[model samples]
Target: MNKLWGFIVAYFLRWFPHGLEPGLRRIGNPGPESPVLVSGNFSLTLKRLIRSLVGQDLWLLVANSRGINVWCAAVGGMFTHHNVIAAIKTSGLADQVRHREVILPQLCAAGMDVKAIREEAGFQVRFGPVRAEDLPAYLAQGKKKTDAMSRFRFDLRHRLDMLLSNNTMFYLIVAIPLAIFWPHRLLAFTLLFWAAAFYLYLLFPYLPGKTGWSRSLYSALAVVLAIPAADFFRAGQPFLHYGWMIAVVLVFSTVGFDAAGILAAMPSDAEAFLHRLGIKRLGSLLQEKTLGRVALDREKCRGDMICYSICPVGVFGELDPDKKITLPWQNACFACGACVKQCPHDALSLQPRP
Candidate 1:
C-alpha cells in the first residue's frame, strides 16, 4: 500500500468503509510454529498493525469486517466467530500453523464468542492488548498483556488525530453551505471549529464531568458567555456579537457532544442520551446498555484476573492476595461487558441497577 495514500484515506475518509483484500498475510518470515493473529480488513487498522508486526514471524488472518475497524465490526456483528472460522478454514492457516492460538484484539471482546470460535474454528482465542502498538511488547514479554496495555489513553496526539478524523467530513460538508451562503464568515467558521475542536479534545481530560456530553455543556456555556465578556472588554460598547456567540455555542456544543462518541471512555454516554430521546435505531447501535453493574461471584472466583486484564476503564481493581477481585472503580463501567465475556470461571456478572 502507498503509505501516504493509506494515511490520507484512513484519516480523511474513515466514515466510508474501505478495505484491503482479506486473507492471510505474512510478517517477516513465518514457520509452522509461528504465532497467529487476527484483524479486520479495514485499511487503516491494517496499516497500523502491519507496522507493529514488522520484523516478526507470524501469520495475520485478516477477517472480513465490511471494511470497518475490528472493534466496530465485531460489535456490529460483522466480525463474529463466523468470520474467524471462515478465515481459518479458507486461508489454509490451520495447515500452515501448528498452534491453535489466535491473538484477537481485546476490544472485540464484547462481540466475539470465545467458546464458539474455539469450537467452530479449533483455535483458542487469546485477546491481545487493546492497542496495536502494544503487540510488540506483549509478544516480547512472552505473550502477556500487561494491565497498562489494556487501559485506554486519549492522549494529546491521539486526541488530535481523532479531532482531525472526526471533523474532516463535518468540515467538508459544512464548508460548501458556508461558502455558498455565508461566504464572508466561511473563514471564521472554519477557524472557530478548529479552535473549539482543539480546545475540547486537547483539554478533554481536565474538563469536568464523567461523560463527554456533560463536559461539553460547560464548554458551550463558556462560549456563550464569552461574547458578553468580549463586549465588556471593548469598553462597554454594544458589539451585537450575539451571532458569533451563537456560532461559538453551536460549535462547542457540537464538538463536545461528539466527544462522547469519539472518546473511548465516554463512547456510550452521548448515544445513551440520544437513545433516551427516542433515536433507538441509531443510539442503540453502540451506546444502549441492557446490562447494569458488573458483579463478581466469590464462590466461582478463580482470580485468573482476566477481567482485570481486559478492562479498558480499569473498573476491576487489582487482584487480592487471596486471588479474589474487587470493583473499586465500579462506576466507570460503560457496560461493554469485556470483563464478563472474557472471565474464564464465569465468576463475573452484570447486576441490574437497584
Candidate 2:
C-alpha cells in the first residue's frame, strides 16, 4: 500500500514538483571488480534505471539534484562535480566501495569536467549509455556502450510525460478554481484549456518553422477563437452577453499565460509573458544585502572553479593572475548553489542572511 501511494506521488511529480531518487546497489566489496554507477535522484528515472539493472550486480550512486531529472539538471548545471563529491562523501562511498572509480551517465558529461573530478576527488570517472535500459547488455559485453545505447529518444510517451509535468500546476490551481467558481461558463473554458494543453503537447514537435514567439502567438490566437465558439455552443440562452465575453477573455488570457510557461524556449520568454499578463514579476528576488555573500575558506579551496564558472546568473568573476577566483559582482548571486557543486575543497558556499 505504501509503495502504491509512493508511485502515485511519483507519477504526479513527473509533471509537478520533482520526485525522489532511486536507491543504489553496491555491487562488490572494496575491489577492482565492482563497478560503481552514478545517476540523478529523479524518482522516475531512478526507478527505470534500477529496474534495468535488475539482473546485474552493480553499485549505483544517486546524486542529489534537487529532485530534477538528469538531463534537465545537467543542462541547468546543477549536477556537477561538487554535487558528486558531496554525495560520495556523505554516502561514505570511500569506505564502502573499495575501488576509487565511479561510472557516470553520458548525458551528464556536459555539466561535469571528468579531469577536474578525477584530480580533485581522486576517482576515475567512466561515462555509461544515455539510457539505463541498455546497461545490462553494455556491461555484459565488457562494460561497453553499443550504438543503440548511446542514442537519445523522445517518443509519444516521453512527450506526454513532459506535458503532464508542465501543466500539473495549471490543472490543480487554475483549472479547479475556475470550475468551482463559475461552473457553467468555466466548464467549457476548462475543457478548452485541457484540449489545448494536450494538443500542443502532442503537436509541438512537428510544428512548422517558427520561433517561440510565433508559436505562442498562434496558440494565443487559437485560444481566442476557440473559447468563444465553445461558449456559444454550450449556452442555449441569449448568446451575446457582455459578462460571457468577459469570462471568455479571462479564460483565454489565463490559458495563454499557462501556455507561455509550457511552450517557451527560453525561461526569459516565459517571464516576459507572465509579466505582460501581470501574473508575477520575472526577475529573481534576493534579500539584496543577504544574497551577495559567498563564504570562501581560502585555506580549504583547491583552486577549483566548479562554482566559479557554472553560475547561471554570472555571479562569479574571473580568476586572477595568481589563480584566485573573484566574484566582483557578488551582488548578482541568487544563491542557487552552482559554486558549491564545483568547489572541490568545499570552500565556497552560501551562508544564511543575518
C-alpha lDDT score of every prediction, in listed order: 0.79, 0.60
Q: Residue 237 in candidate 1 has what lDDT? A: 56
The TM-scores, one per candidate, come to 0.90, 0.62
The model with the greatest TM-score is: 1
List runs of model 2 lying over 4 Å from the truth.
Answer: 1-9, 14-24, 27-32, 95-98, 146-148, 219-354
Give the root-mean-square deviation of each candidate in angstroms. Answer: 2.7, 9.6
lDDT of 1 by residue, 1-354 (tens): 676776776787566677889999999899999888899899887889999888888899998887878766665566677888888899998889988899998887877888988888899999889889899899989889777898877677778878877767667787899899989979989999898888888888888877787787788787778778888888685457888877777777777765865665644665566557865334212434444668888889888788887887789887787888888988767677778877878897878645
* Model 2, span 1-354: residue lDDT tens: 967755655665443335564444564342435688888887777888878877676778888866766655664566677778767767767766677888887666556766677887778886677778888787778867655565454456765775665555456676577678867756666675677667666775565424434554565556466655776787843344545455444543443443423343222234444445665432111001112246666667666665543454445566777677777866544443445644667778777434
The superposed Cα distance between candidate 1 and the true structure at residue 273, in angstroms, equals: 2.0
